[model samples]
Target: MPGDSRAATNAATVLRTVLEHGPVARGGIAGLCGLSPAAVSRQTTALLRGGLLRELPGPADGVGRPRIPLDLHTGAVGGPVAAGLHIGVPSSTFSLVDLRGRLLARRAFPHEGRPPAGLSGEIAVGLGRFLAEFDSGRPLLGVGAALGGWIRPDEGTVVHHPVLRWRHKPLGAELSAVLGLPVRVDNHARAVARAEILFGRPEARGSLVHLFIGNVVDAAFGIEGTVHQGPGSAAGDVAHLPVPGSAAPCACGRTGCLQATASDTALGAEAVRRGIVPDPSVPLLVDAAATGDPRADRLLRERARAVGRAAALLLDVFNPALMVVTELSSVLDEGYLEEIRTAATALSHVCDDPRRIVIPHAGPAVLPEAAATVLLSRVFRDPCRSDERARSHPSV
Candidate 1:
């Protein structure tokens, strides 16, 4: 078993190389992984046997001795998969991800105020049905549930999720007991940072901070390709951080907390207060801001400034190689991103001219993809193990 695990880890490394630079020659993989050509050949043979690698067509010009390249085979039998579920305040998403960073299937739905216990049961049934859709030869590694709140991963529990009204909920255990599979539960921001390490830009591997700006404001720090979770996984709690020039009252009896003034929910509420929108909803406020409403623009710009300030604080403390911001509307737009950057540069001592910043250029699936990455990472960690499981179980 240990030998198989090690082989799986090596196979995973090879698979990762192909995933990053697919249709790549065996010699290139050997050079990248620092393995001999023979070793690479053996690994490729095993991967092909396991149905994880497939050869792509060579040059169309019919050039000199065709050098075939390998790719991570998807939508095929024998590839490992994992289910990922992200539970938000208004909705939840279920996704399936292959170890090769391909999304197999995904669906989002509203919860209609189901309690945590009931929601766990619903997820169990849903996951069962989803898994049934795939070929049984496709190994299902496990499931990961991501949510917005404080999470105690070591204890396999959600310490608190204000939006879901969950406290001390055994989410991982509940799902595991019901689904009969391994389960991981974590904060959505933390999970997103992990996702970056697994599937984002190459630079995302080193020291970095992922700032998630949506209904709530939170951050996660990754160091040397791993999340730096502090005591009880509460390292990046920036929601309560105080912001200057904001007098908004916070639920914590404090004034000007980041969440009180900078979160999308807060901004939308402020938009309604300022008569920019009829109802307090982020989508509505975004629409108003897009339509050249001065009130909406001003409110969003102020919130963007607040976000920039918070990011500057993170940079000052962490001084990471880069910071990835994922805001719903403002940060995604170039003009608005610049506004936040300008405000942040003005506020922080060392964050001036902070050019080492980035945002996901990919569209709406960022959050769901991140959630799925949480589970897919396990397969990438050890492909041989997953392959073994796939072989152990036979589809009828």
Candidate 2:
């Protein structure tokens, strides 16, 4: 490997080791990451100076200062924080998270009839106000924006967002220009997959598939801790994937497509049509189900089954170590998640263990944490570059 690349790898290894085993000594990081003591020392010094790591009080057992524990700088005052923006059809969620991907604060900006032409600017204004209210004098790293559709993260562009009517828009640069901070953008499905690998279960790093069910339904695949972004970074489009036993008509004139059958938009519209909710809103439907509405419950179960059948197809193809389903009802209620797992296990020929299909580790906060991980993931991959970016953009 080249000198710079080797150094970056070593730095990431040390940083991740500390993230997994916090309040640990440098010797422990070296042992865990298989790095030499000198390399660990070098990276730790850089990390500490860059405000990524902080030294904790050493043991009272009379151990020398060399045993001083180190951990991610998650202090309430001066620790670094990344802003998260998740743009959905109905609303956009803004969040602030620590280095460990823990959400600190979050606010929802409902579009509510806002025109899509300049919605990005409106979201940026709302996000700026949210940050101002929750600033806490911390070192703001930047913003990580995640949304649906074909997003080109390399160029920070939204290749296409059907619901939002965005086409080849430079979302990152636009958000950065308005917010006065660096912004990184990616498909929300891939953002959730990367978040799972970085902060969720250990099995996710080995291999995982994340299925996002929302206004848009999509899937992301990861292997060996790397999320795959195929040609044009348009890998996770499961909108048109056929779902078993679903006869819902899609906009493309196709019947039984996954998004048409299982997405929140479809489910909400169906709920409204069935008189289960007043409007096309999944949250209202879920609330009705929680309030002992049998009609709502049955509708949700039906959608869950469709999602499970679609998951089965992905499982049969990838057979990943884990399948993470991000759905509102499932994340909030275990009974719904069980319905999905049972249906998926029954349909998947390769996966008999229902335990393999689960909700995101962040549960209800999945989108918020996943959106922030869009930037935190980059920081973990190359701390040197992250530090450089932070130094270059100090006003955030």
Candidate 3:
């Protein structure tokens, strides 16, 4: 229903409250959301009717009647699901996620040369094959694509991806046309940050920074449980941040950029150049370091320092409550993380406890899960809004 701003805000608040503390009583929701029981009941009724929330049976205690709890209708195995797609430089991944961001299925495909003109169609076919394994009784909410480089989420276009040589690609629209589903697209690192905010342990809320350290070096900041997507969704473009004491050249034809020094590509190339590893790959370098190879250790320490410098710079600017670093195996070492902490503390004018920084070892499945969380978060953020679109399609 077309409603006033206050009503919309109330509904959104109730939905988020339920998502965060579901299987909870309406009275508890009212207290948590700062709304009266009557208001919460009204909003929850609307949500239940919209098929976004379900009521659980109340406990049969020997005392008075128990109040039924309200929760997001996401636990059902035969309920609706969302398709997540990630287009990276080396490979593409697809995953199925329920409304709560739980992974149902995941698959990856590696490609070489360049992305073809019919890449969207190819991905759509792959998703179709992946979906065939699941029960067809479940409805599909939409597809969320995570691409590297600049993205305009509002327009669902990838403005630029130098790694993939893609420019001004209407990826979301193309994929949507192929699959007959709604599509949303954004930068891969930012998408991962969104997932961290939505599904991470210790429940990362308030101010947070997520750093992705692999083939690319990018960061995303989450404030007040929402990612700080700046104008044009280009807020976390820290790849070009200048790094001191490094002579590496950046892809932008510049010297000493963060990506040139801290990225896995840079580390791998340096490992091969220094004869530490015959192959230029992160896994090989990490393996060599794990085996106590002095040369590999030296290279990794150098890269770790560079990443520390970048982290320091970010801390100075954002002063996030916590910083989550991904793909940095050396983070397990107190000495290694101390290097980052020391640099950040020294460089950042606003100092906080260094222990706030953490590294998440999510393995290869992180990207696919990140892509799916992009769609899942939207539902949690505004169930009423997304439910409208879901109602239109009913099933996909």
- Evaluate residue 150 in candidate 3 and report its C-alpha lDDT on the 0 to 100 scale: 83
TM-score of each: 0.84, 0.97, 0.87
- Scored against the true structure, residue 251 in model 1 reaches a CA lDDT of 98
- What are the per-residue Cα lDDT tens digits for candidate 1 across 1-396? 677666666787887888788778888898888777876787788887766677777666765322577887765666667788887766788888776555778887677767655776886777767667754687676787788889987666988877667789988878888887778778888888888788777778877898888776779999987897788888778889888787889999999898888887788787888888898787788778788887877777777788888888888888877788877665446766787788777877766665766675334566777777766665566655552354477431
Better of 2 and 3 by TM-score: 2
What ranking of all candidate models by TM-score puts the best one first? Answer: 2, 3, 1
lDDT of each: 0.76, 0.93, 0.75
lDDT (10s digit) by residue, model 3, range 106-189: 888765553566566777787767767764667787788887788888778988776666788888778777777778888878
* Residue-wise C-alpha lDDT for candidate 2, range 230-279, written one tens digit per residue: 99998989999999999999999999999899999899999999998999
Minimum summed lDDT over a 10-residue window in model 3 is located at: 58-67
Clashing pairs in 1: 8-384
Global CA lDDT of candidate 1, please? 0.76
Candidate 2 has what TM-score?
Answer: 0.97
For model 2, which pairs clash? none
Clashing pairs counted in every model: 1, 0, 0
